[model samples]
Target: MLYSPFLVTLTLLTLLTASARAQQSGPVVATPQRPPVTEQDRTEAQKFVAEHHPELASLLSQLQKSRPAEFERALRELVPQTQAIQRSKERSPARYESQLAAWKIDSQIRVLMARWSRKQDPETETKVRELIAHRQQLRREQTQAEKQRLTEQLQKIDEQLQNLDQPETQRIQAEWEQLSRRATIAAKQATKQKTNTTGEKKTTAKKSSDQQPAAAQPSPGSR
Candidate 1:
């Protein structure tokens, strides 16, 4: 059907968008769990989903007309997708476990992309963006331990330069430039997989805030 791809894309984007907007609260998931599917459960879910499916079909038009970011959180949680459904194969349990696994992976990738785009927290995002900007500044054989050693050296130089009567600013700057560029390269390859027309890199960041049970938030100033 002409609507199939649109539906799938809408549902996936909704699920991911909701996850990013949510502010995580307390100690929650050991691991996310799904309840076992009963026949009544399957019937109710299927009927409701089929009836409301057109809401999702209309999402893109709605998105274009509204502030998608603001509305995304409320919409994502309520939309049901095949990944969380309880369907019978010949009136038995799911016969498509592999499909389930693949669906999860696809959802995860999309969510990470949403997380990066929003720049929800600049401190964390700067780290992500810096990595993206500086990718390809290094070689493949480098190890984590090696990188740390270089970073430490630059840090010491940074500190010494701070205390200087006449700072060896040029020397310190050169050293930092070398290690930072390499780290930047490695970070980019590890993250970005696609690019938008705006030339911004796209990636997914998912959170199952609904499927994931929310931990109770602490009262303000009550640590």
Candidate 2:
């Protein structure tokens, strides 16, 4: 049957729309990836860690365990796992970003937990375990719930810092400023007060030593 040109054009357009919809229903679009961390970026991140959280300097300085390197490894390792979510996202792009955000959140939590892991105290160790357990819950959470919980955890940490003394306050603030910038901020914070104490002792010693000779001097009556 002969068809009008307008009818033929309309038919082609209709077929294209159906094909596009079918593709949408069968596979989620893979997201454009963020650039992976570079060696220079790693070095900068390392320097940032040193300036902001130097205690991790040694552990991270090994060149093998740096945050950039570790994060790069984690992103690579998470690839297969993200792929597993492909089937679930097949229905919509909305789900894809949601899944990605959840994955990112999970990764961030792990990074945070690792930083908190070097504590030598048993009580802190127990709290770390509890923090980890809640993180696992965060992973399983719905998007809205996870975000709310994330906010709550962050605020709780902030409140804990508020309750701490000035030295603790400074440490927590410094570390938070470099969440992804360092891997050892917490460890550095833990030693901050002690380090300040050492500084105080050195100043006190100098003052005492400076006075010692004068105090030991011969009096005016001494020949």
Candidate 3:
């Protein structure tokens, strides 16, 4: 993760907005979210592998038969390719940019809702209520200029929220989802490799164990 504040805010708001929509139906559907991997990322990653590491594409079957060293070497080579894909872009696709803006505004609505849910300080409650009401009024404005002004206001709010030491819970949750997904995938891959290796070792050990008894028995007549 590159800690570009602007990209962080943009990505956080994007996921937050999606989560809010899901929440409206009932409970929020909590899926592990990864950082926005655009089509460009996939394309470039495939291209890199095909161009630089064509053999890796077929490593799965080969790894089963090859030495563990070969598998480790392949994984080592993939790390830089993965990093290049991840660092390729700091922003989402252009088609998603407008959606991000809309989601940014929706996330503020969620912020207000979360504050209200806490029901803690009366002062904070009143302030949040006022912000919600103001946002609703902005939504009702008929003029294009008024809408643009509202968008600007929302953008400023997003920037301010991004700067806070403790980010809004929604943003934190969204980031966690991204990190969790990445971790989960890596963990699953490691577990799978371990299982396969363990299975292979067990099979080899069993064969050796079975052969030992037969060898010790010698010829039938010797027994």
Query: Top TM-score: which candidate number?
Result: 2
Q: What does each candidate score in C-alpha RMSD?
A: 31.0, 24.4, 26.4
Whole-model alpha-carbon lDDT for candidate 3: 0.51
Clashing pairs in 3: none
TM-score of each: 0.21, 0.24, 0.22
* Candidate 2 per-residue C-alpha lDDT over 1-223 given as tens digits, one digit per residue, 9 for 90 to 100: 3333333222222222232234235666675765665556556554544553343333333324334444344333333444544555786666665665554444333433443443356664666566567646655565575588789999999998776756877878877878845657677876998899999999999999987855577878996
Residues forming the 10-long window of minimal summed lDDT in candidate 3: 1-10
Q: Give stretches of model 1 more than 4 Å off.
A: 1-79, 88-94, 119-223
Compare candidates 1 and 3 on lDDT and give the better one.
3
Candidate 3 lDDT, 134-159, residue by residue in tens: 65554454246557878999999998
TM-score, model 2 to reference: 0.24
- Evaluated at residue 190, the lDDT of candidate 3 is 100
The lDDT for every candidate, in the order shown, is 0.47, 0.51, 0.51
Candidate 1 shows a clash count of: 12
